[model samples]
Target: MEILDLGLDILTWAAILIGCFFVIITGYGLLRFPDLYSRIHAGGMADTLASFLILGGLALQSGLTLVTVKLIFIIAFLFITSPTATYALAQATFVAGLKPRVDEGQLDDTPPTDKVEGGKD
Candidate 1:
């Protein structure tokens, strides 16, 4: 095998390893994170990145096979659906009037009902 082929193999393995790492980190984040929003963020970030990495590595390994086409399809589905799921979750939180963390950056414009009415029910 050529040096270039060896390099590609190394990269493919690296991508797969990193994909596993993302999955593990997300699992840990789900257990360790303080709040729902933060946990959601971690889950989304890890899932998206891991999908990218795994699909990329699979594509590399698949070369010109039908597996590559299937991997591409999987990646496309993931890319389309993950963001939509995350957006729906965030919208649900917002519409449900979930409060953002105080340390969370750049909050929305909607004022809380308690703040406006001066004494929550």
Candidate 2:
């Protein structure tokens, strides 16, 4: 029993550490990504995966109990809401006329930038 318990603890810790790593990577993505769309994509995907890993770790640590139930509920909520929220934000940005940056090799489909006739040279 003791050995099993120790092994479970080790697995839980590993999951938590991996989750934290993903979160740190997400932060880096936010800083390094060149545009809003890319940043959102990176952050959203990492965040969803990280949440699953971290919550799974917590659920394992909790064992069979009310805490575990609550953790599962939280994970369910996150799973449903995160992607929906990201999609809504991206949609809103599109409706608001925000354009994503295009690389030289990529075909540009975004509307042309509006020129301000009186803007400073």
Candidate 3:
């Protein structure tokens, strides 16, 4: 029983540490990304994954208890809502005429840099 408890503790801590690492990366992305769209994408992805992992670790620590059950519900809510919220935000931005930056070889109404640069062929 002691060995099992020790193993659970280690696993819980490992999950938490990994979740923290992801959260740090997410913060860096939110600061360093070039545009709103990219920043949103980075933040949404990392936040969901990190939250899930962190909650999972907490649930493990809580074991078979009401706290664990609540954690599971929270995780489910997050998983369901995060993506929907991101999509809505993106749609709102689009409706507001916020154009996303596109790379070369992509189809967009925005004129290419080469064309704008004196029509160089």
Among all candidates shown, the one with the greatest lDDT: 2
lDDT of 1 by residue, 8-120 (tens): 89999999999999989989887776666777888896658898998899899778999999888888888899889999888777666666666646644443433222222
C-alpha displacement of 105 in model 1, angstroms? 11
| Order of quality (TM-score) | 3, 2, 1
List model 3 lDDT by residue over 1-121, tens digit each: 9999999999999999999999999998887766678789788956488998899999999999999999999989988988888898888777666677776754444332431223223
Computed on alpha carbons, the lDDT of every model, listed in order, comes to 0.79, 0.82, 0.82
lDDT-superior candidate, 1 or 3: 3
Compared with the true structure, the alpha-carbon lDDT of candidate 2 equals 0.82
Q: Could you tell me how far off, in angstroms, the CA of residue 38 lies in candidate 2 after the best superposition?
A: 0.3
Model 3 vs truth, CA RMSD = 8.1
Of 2 and 3, the candidate ranking higher by lDDT:
2
Provide TM-scores for the models: 0.76, 0.82, 0.83
Candidate 2 clash figure, as a count: 0
Q: Least accurate stretch of 10 residues (summed lDDT) in model 3?
A: 112-121
